[model samples]
Target: MMYHHLSDAMLDDYLRDVPVPVGLVARLKQTAVPNDAELDELLRSPPMPDGLVDRLQAAIQDEILDESLRQTKVPEKLLVRLRTIPRARRRSAWRRFAVAASLLVVLFSAYCGSLSALLAAMRPKQNRDTTLTIIELYVDPTHSSLLTMSEADPTTIRFAPPTSAEMAELPIELARLDLTPALGPAGHLLQEVRRGAPLTEDVFLMRRNTLGSPQTNDQALPELSHVRRRQIAGVDLPLAPGYDRAFFLKSGIHPPVFPAAGQPTEAIQVPLVTRTDSVDLTRRLLLEGRTPSPSDIRVEDYIAAVRYGLQASNDQSLVLYATAGPSIFGRQPHHMLHLGVKAPRVQTATSTHMSIVVDVSASMRGDDRIGAVHRAFEIVLRHLGPNDSLSFVAVNHEIVRQVDFLPASGAAQLASMIRDLDPSGGDNLAKGFQAAMSLAFEAEVAAGSARHVVLITDGQAAIGDRDAARMRDLVATGETFSIRSTFLQLDRLISAETVPSSTGLEHASAVSPRQLPWRLVTLATGQSPVVARQARLQVAFNPQAVLAYRLFGRGPTAVTGLADVGVETDLHSGEEASALFELWLRPNGTEDVGWAEVHWTDPATGSPLTTERMSIGRSDIAVSDDETLWPLRAVAIVSEVGQRLSGIGDFELLNGRRFSQRKKPAGWKDVLEQAVGVHPSAGEQSDFQQMVDLIRQLEELALRGPK
Candidate 1:
């Protein structure tokens, strides 16, 4: 078929009432007929039309259908009616051209609505001066607190310290600190405060008594019911000798709602390790024919539970890849942004000295918790190479026994000793931790080895420390010596929160018999070699290009009474982290949508930090069939499952409007098709499908249940 350039006469005929040949519409749809450069240049000009290709395609299809019907024989009445219709006369070329130009203006104006929206969205607004909103993750090593602050808001939100009763709810370490002097009579420490520069939502407060000797201040501080607000320049206090303080305001991980035009930037701190206890619990509940509580489902854990097979950076720099696509869970105009980050891979030169604390308390006997520990140890033994050393400490209401560090050659003896362990009596966890720390401290100093203390328990008893201060001192002493610790809960029979959070532990996990091996392996690999410490990923969306955005999973919500947030999340060698965001792009916006950056302290240097960044633009958008998008597809599927199970209804952005609604059956079908058919089953895709199926069954049962 021959195709020609769209001439002025052709455009005039199409714009006018004059009937044009059916072939003209088809020719316009041809790629060779219209010069893309010419069309794009025209679109770039003022009053240029958008969606020209779509309009042409639609017009061509309609004309083809009309011509096919015209080929068929018509009834006598229809033929007579057609003949009776008025025959329009063709106008002169100049007159026709004049009319076509007017019509073209109207069409261009219609398309420019989207263009105007794009420009308006990008235009700077009054009072919102910053082009970037960076939420940096700050970890105070001295106070052991993880602080995430948004550098967008100037207003400082202040809340009074926890009262006497509220203080009891604080972690053991923080609860023991005497703050009466600092808080004063009405907790009015920072009076006559003033607002300074813009600050992010500061979400944590941590304090420590740095004095060599304890100070006796018997002043009483009254309890207040409500939180007092003050626009303070910063967290400042006239401190007594040897007392240090830090404070920040708090907010949920994702705000209840957001407007694209109002808050175009969305960010979250990427988790270094995968957490699966919540995912495991939800699956267990479904298997037992019971619905899991919404609170029990952590979206971050679910998504993290599925390994995306992302590789680590080969060099010292962090690796970051970002891409966006049409959202599957959300309606039209909503897009999903996927970010995959990897820390640099580091090689370990020294061996690790591990102090394994076992809780042989009778409570562990109920679920064969001891057996789970044995299985976990078996996996640990496999990962322990010739350079590694291990020790065992038993605790039952008190310290039962302690075994000094043994080389990897003693694995057989260690396994034998572990198998011989028996559950009895209760547990004094504080004492157990002390003994394990002592062993680790000794080993670290003697051999200059990596010191790690692993505590395995059923989390059924409290440390027999009435003062609380003593236990805090003990844990702080271990931290002072740079002893790393991890808590492994043998069972979740009790609330997982009961496990001590103030013990300076890197991570706490509940292990089932089936998950014991995998969890241990994950832990082992995660502890392989330290690559980056205090690592954080920050993404800033271009307000002009991106209208609004929201993130999936609880990225960084504040937990009251907790000093640190994700303090234990250090990037291990070859570990990958992922995040998903729902984005609404401005129509006809610039290709420069946003950018991502990662900052972390290099473990080797430990002084000056390192940073790497990548630009996200229109070209970064990927189609469903793109093989490189599997990780993102996997993240999306896992995140959707989490949102559905958690009862946080799916977020939808239609046109420019945003809302939340329960996902429909069709939505699930689309997710399942992508998960099973399109996305590769490289990681936990199969298990994810099972989770999807289970959620469907539960939904079906829910609809059949009482309202």
Candidate 2:
């Protein structure tokens, strides 16, 4: 029962401590005081703890027939609940009446909420002007495992409980481009560079390329600069991060943008901005939930697909995280990286053209390994325009011509090369890579383009003990030629090929142990840096359950010893990027969980930067799965939590199933719908109404299919 609305005199008396349970008096205090007769009657005697109010209400009910309750009896349990209230007295009929009245009031409030459209119709009209706020972030792709949710009405929001039909699936619906676009120039709107802000309140200023059209090679994108200030989905868009903005943008025009892969938003061109001005430490309002705090609307964010293990052992202890650094409005990096740390000096006599050499050994002939390489090579060729050139070669028992450091051609020739690949032979990874590097160096000298070598291999060099030395030789060659070597592994079957891989992994830490063999070809030939540089992350935490936490393998990644801490991800050799870490915290003594900070470097120039801080308090909830989600987070959480609870081993989730958004709800649908229903409509009809609406929707819901 609400105590604040009680009669002022009675409330003051209750706070002052007159022993509770004065039935008539308590009822008089909790209910509206009738006229002079009622007032005089209450003054005659202190009300008893029972009977009086019920009798009075019953008498009123008997006299007035219009508003009789179908079930008017008040139970002891409700009255008992009221007794502990600081302002409430002991259990009594009077307390029961008060409880009944409170319930009635709540029903009426809900009734009002259901008629929001009618109330809105009666209220003054909005300016009809809609402003779109743009947001963006950087992401590392090697280690990330994000999936995209295609259904659940990105256009119109519905008020319903999350059902099995609404859950999102993994690996299948997991579109890396859906949230944060893969490393391409198309999402440049959110991919613009960011400079750090002092990050106190609404003080940080986010700036971008502010384009009106697509940006292409050597050409600046068109610009539309007047900032529009309208709240999207109950969230205010100002110059602010994810909260309310300071000004109103011109009305009626929709912001241009699209929900980036692994990011938020669906509009095109015009960027979307979020609420929080910058990062925060103490607040737990960053991620989404049914009950949002002021801080939740202030930032735009989503949970990461991969759950880091507690102490890097098990994936339990999920933490909620908010958008910060470059990840807020754009795609961010999946893995934490640092490059050029101890890069040897290059004594190049001339600038070299970019080139990559691949290994088409027998080990990679099967299972589309060669196919993946061909696809990557094709994408890279397309990425290059007039002024650029590349040279490609395939190494087997003998070096074979793929592109041969020649100028790229129209799509036809590239396709023929890709389709002609035939893989089979003894593994000679070292020679293949060496020949590729030498060819890349020679191509650079001939064409005057940046030089690089990409090595794709499934096994270590077949030379046994000399394998390590051979790999080292490849790295040294890249250094000597001022070219960077990007090593990509296809399948994990090469675990036995130890020496060559170990040496290469040590030098090219950015390489992924599980990428398709083709990606290596792209990396070696691509111009973007292989890793981000000079990155840092700072996290402020809710003093609740966060007694201590540790970052695994990453340097000093633990925060237990320090009062406050900042984390960083850096080292860029290819294109620039950042990442978001959702840290669901379990507060002490309270099931309410909170999250930590995720920050990174400016992709343009490795510089320290922070994102709008997001914190989600503890929760003891076990969300039911949504069939529509196809077990995205549901599976992620299950795997992480299962590993945590069972102390089992870690495994990568691979999706062999695909579900359509139009398909009937079954598994993932149940997961997503459950989360969607947890959050009240709050009268939000559009996803953009509250920029955090969708993220909140995601936070409230998680889905995983049968293991």
* Each prediction's number of clashing residue pairs: 9, 169
Off by over 4 Å in 2: 1-56, 59-352, 365-368, 382-385, 398-401, 408-412, 419-422, 430-438, 441-449, 464-510, 513-601, 604-707
lDDT of 2 by residue, 237-333 (tens): 1232211111113211112111122222211111121112111110112221122322222222221111111111122111222221111111211
Q: How much lDDT does each candidate structure score?
A: 0.59, 0.38
- Provide the lowest-lDDT 10-residue window in model 1: 228-237
Q: If candidate 1 were superposed on the true structure by all CA atoms, what would the RMSD be? A: 31.0
Which residue window of length 10 is worst by lDDT in model 2? 336-345
Report the CA-based lDDT of candidate 2 relative to the real structure: 0.38
lDDT of 1 by residue, 1-707 (tens): 23257788877776797778989878877846658888888778867379988999999999999999987655556889878968888869999899999999999998999899999999976544222222335833343322222234433222223222221112212134665556562234234123442212222211222222112222112211222221111111122221111211222234222323333223334444444555655644554456566645667766666656656556666677776777655555467888876665444356677787888876665544675676467546656656777888988877877788787688667776776877677667777877887787778334555677777776565544452455566566767776766777755343233344433343666654545554544444444455677776777777667766666664323232223344235665445666777776777888887778777777777764645567899677764445346666677777877776666665554332333344444234555556665444553433455556655765655656522
